[model samples]
Target: MNSPVVRLRGLTRSFEQGGVRIDVLRGVDLDINRGEIVALLGPSGSGKSTLLQAVGLLEGGFGGNIAISGTDAETLDASGRTELRRNHMGFVYQFHHLLPDFNAIENVVLPQLVAGRARATAEDRAAELLTALGLAQRLDHRPSQLSGGEQQRVAVARALANRPELVLADEPTGNLDEATSDRVFAEFLSLVRGEGSAALVATHNERLAARMDRVVRLHEGRLQHQGKADA
Candidate 1:
């Protein structure tokens, strides 16, 4: 766990809009160790999402090195990147993005099934995660029936369903009320820690960010340390 689960060195990303060049990430360097939870704090449009996209291997045109679990992302082709992502990464967004037709447990189970886990095994994993997240009684409830916090909890369960080595969350609790956000984010932190997986959570809430193991602020396309996180 001492070594980095994910490492970024000299990362850079830019875009051209209306003939004006905009740099989102510029020579950023970071390391996220196994079992560590890191908070990424920044206001909207601060390149937090772009940094996450690079780490998630969700896009191209990023220039730099992204090494995850000892594999360099630049070394993999499209299919290989997809395989790496499927095998090692999970994601949660500002929106829950649960499958409307599926129940809470099913939403979590589907990802495991896609990852080739046996149906029984997948169901068991889903049940364990949802139950731990306090959704035991609502396993069969659809997203439409769940409250906002419950829906986000299901999303957190789904993100951890495959036992991903790294979970990337972007504004995960942004949609909820402060009370709901605190509860949901606390559960998310607990679940991620329990699984022994590293996390990079992007959030604008200083209150929420302060709870992680470490805090990094994204400013002007670079990351600045904000000191150690809460214990």
Candidate 2:
């Protein structure tokens, strides 16, 4: 296996409210290799999303070492963190956060634009990704006009637009029906694998988690690796 694309050592996350400290993650040690599809599963508030956010650089108040693609994240400043996130990480949430006014293609290209790519170049790459995701015909459709699956597919395409080293998906298919969710998961896995990017998806759905290469349960506060399975 290749060196870890993502590594978390002695990771801890805590939130203080009204002088009370709530621990969300307690010393989480995880390593995700390139091209691996790993799922985080557990009951509500099991620190699944917290772990994702921590590793994805969405949260930084915690203590520990987070290394992505061989760079120690703890040593980076705000701008450095932002740069790493923009250049090496991709994120997909349960809700497709597509802009209401932008069409599918435009939505997918937004990230590339944020990364300083030319509009024409970003659009071209976005179009290609949308085409591969079976959203070619929906290119002109806005978020409101597209179906749930199509919107999520567009989000997936957006996640891949930058060819990120790691993709963090938080209940990405939660809003879709079973069939649609399965299709979306298939497309997501295929896309990540094809691009040799690692993915850590947070999900409550056992069936969906089973489809991943490895199932990891975030129990209490740490990640416990369950065995692999064939979906």
Q: Report the Cα RMSD per candidate.
A: 1.5, 1.7
Residue 7 alpha-carbon offset, candidate 1, angstroms: 0.3
**Least well predicted 10-residue stretch by lDDT in candidate 2:** 222-231
Best by TM-score: 1
Residue-level error in angstroms, candidate 1, position 154 = 0.5
Off by over 4 Å in 2: 229-231
- Model 2, span 166-206: residue lDDT tens: 99999999999999999988998888898888999999988
lDDT (10s digit) by residue, model 1, range 88-170: 99999999999999999899999999989999999999999999999999999999999999999999999999999999999
Give the runs in model 1 whose Cα sits over 4 Å from its true position. 229-231
Q: How much does candidate 2 score in TM-score?
A: 0.94
Clashing pairs in 1: none
